[model samples]
Target: MERFQRLDAVAVPIARPNVDTDQITPARFLHKPRSDDHGNYLFHDVRRRPDGTPDPGFVMNRPEYAGAQVIVAERNFACGSSRENAVWALYDHGFRAAIAPSFGDIFAANGLKNGLLPVRLPEDVVAGLIAALEAEPGARVQVDLEAQTVTLPDGSVHPFEIDPFSRHCLLNGVDELDYTGTLAPQIDAFMNRYGRENR
Candidate 1:
């Protein structure tokens, strides 16, 4: 997992709500090897037409936001099934963070484990961000995890809420397993004392 202190990147506005995991990475693409190259399959159905050609109308197909690393989406984003691959697809596609009004509970947990920042903000704030990004294509949004704020293009900042433990994990690039491993010394000490008494 990579440390995520702050990020300033091109924002891709996905205006849809309830974008489930199946839509993110279709079940067909799930059979492929579990690697970090799922970017090629991100939004597979939306990005490709029936003829297997690029669909020019898709937001990701637009050349300007092709390499966008941040996604601004509507409410209830990442809702529905809880497939970890969905999070992998987003990360593989270079999206380090997603801003929305809410997210599926399971999806949010999966995202945090995989180093994706699923930011929850007010509905109006999310709508404003979408509108701003649409109006100014290729505009960058800065997300500062350390400061717990989202900096808009106009120099305005919006504060957000994140669990303290999750925040710590993201800041240090540590996953749940890594966090547990941090207590190795205490575990070893307890085991040693118990073993001596058992003898």
Candidate 2:
């Protein structure tokens, strides 16, 4: 996973609430292997019209929000199903972080494991950010994981909290399994000492 110490990129706003995993990546597309570009299926059903063409009405389809690396969303974002594919779709689609009033528990966990930061803030604060992004479609928001703060387009900075271990892993570019592997020397030493003492 790539390190996520800081990000300064365009943020796309999704004003809807309860955007479930199914919407993020339709279940039918889940059969594709991870090696495939899952980003192509991100919001597949919603991003396209019934005729199969890209929907110009969707926020993500807007030309200005192209290549946005951040998502500002309403409450209960990514709710429903414990599919890690939801995180994959977001990360694969170039989003490194998401800011919202709240998020589905499993989605948040999956995000940390995949190098995507899920930031929780007050409802009003998130609303303000979403409003700002909607008003200025191509505006950039700054995220500093080391500082645990997000700088809005209006130049206002808001603090957020994250699990200490998650923060450490993100800053160091290691997943939980990679982090555990780093403790091999200590684990070996402890095992050797225990064997000698017990013998």
Candidate 3:
């Protein structure tokens, strides 16, 4: 996992709501064992037509939003079943942060563990971000995890709250797996004490 301190980059607007985990990566791409190259399969269904041609109208296919590092979307982003692959796809596609009015609890947790910042803001603020991106293509937005603030294109800022543990992990590039590994020393000590008592 990569440390996420501050990010300033162009934000791609995904206006749709109720975007589920399957839609982010699709079931067909789940066969691959490697996380690499999943970016090409991100939004596979929406980005391709029946004949497998690129859908020109899709926000991701648009030239201006190509390589965007942040995504501004509507409410209920990343809903449905809990799949960690969705976070992988987004991160692989260069999207490090997602701003939405609401998100699936499991998806948000998965994202945090994978170094993707899931930002919760008022619906109006989310709408404003979408409008800004639509009106000005390639508009840059700044996300500072340390400050818990998002700076819009026009220089306005909105604050968001994040769990302290999640924030600490993301800042230090430590995932849940890393946290578990950090407890190995204590676990070893406990095991040694238990063995002596049993003997």
Candidate 4:
């Protein structure tokens, strides 16, 4: 997991709500070998037309938003069954943070575990940010995880909320289990001291 102290990147605005996991990465691609580059299948269904050509209508297909690292969306983003792979596909596609009004609980968790910052701001704030990014696709937004703020194009700032521990993990580039693994030495010491006495 990469540390996410702060990021300044061009933003891609996907102005839809309730974008579920299936839409993010269709179920068919779920069983593919992990080494097969899941990023290729990110938003496969939405990004491709029926005849297999790329959908030019999708926000990501636009050339201006190419190499954008931030995703701004509407309410209830990534609402679907708990599949960590959805987060993987987005991460593999180089999205470091997602800003929205709300997100599916499980998806948010998955995102944090994978070092993706899910910023939850108020509805109006998100709407304004998305509107600005959509209108100015070449513009960049600054996301400061340490400050818990999103700096918009107009030089204004909006604050967002995140779990403190999750923020710590992201800043330190550690996953949940990786954090626990850091305590191994203490665990070994405790076991050696207590086990000898118990015997």
Best by lDDT: 2
The TM-scores of all predictions, comma-separated, are 0.89, 0.90, 0.89, 0.89
lDDT tens digits by residue: candidate 2, 64-149: 99989999899999999898888888999999999999999999999998999999989999999899999989999999999999
- Pitting candidate 1 against candidate 3, the one with the higher lDDT is 3
For residues 46-93, what per-residue lDDT tens digits would candidate 3 score against the true structure?
Answer: 999989999998987888887799988899999987878888888888
Q: Which stretches of candidate 2 lie over 4 Å from their true place?
A: 181-199
- lDDT-better candidate, 2 vs 3: 2
Q: Give me the runs in candidate 4 sitting further than 4 Å from their true place.
A: 182-199
Candidate 4 per-residue lDDT, tens place, 25-123, comes to: 898888887677778888998898999898999889999999989898999999987988898898899899998899999999999989788999899
Taking all chains together, the TM-score of candidate 4 against the true structure is 0.89
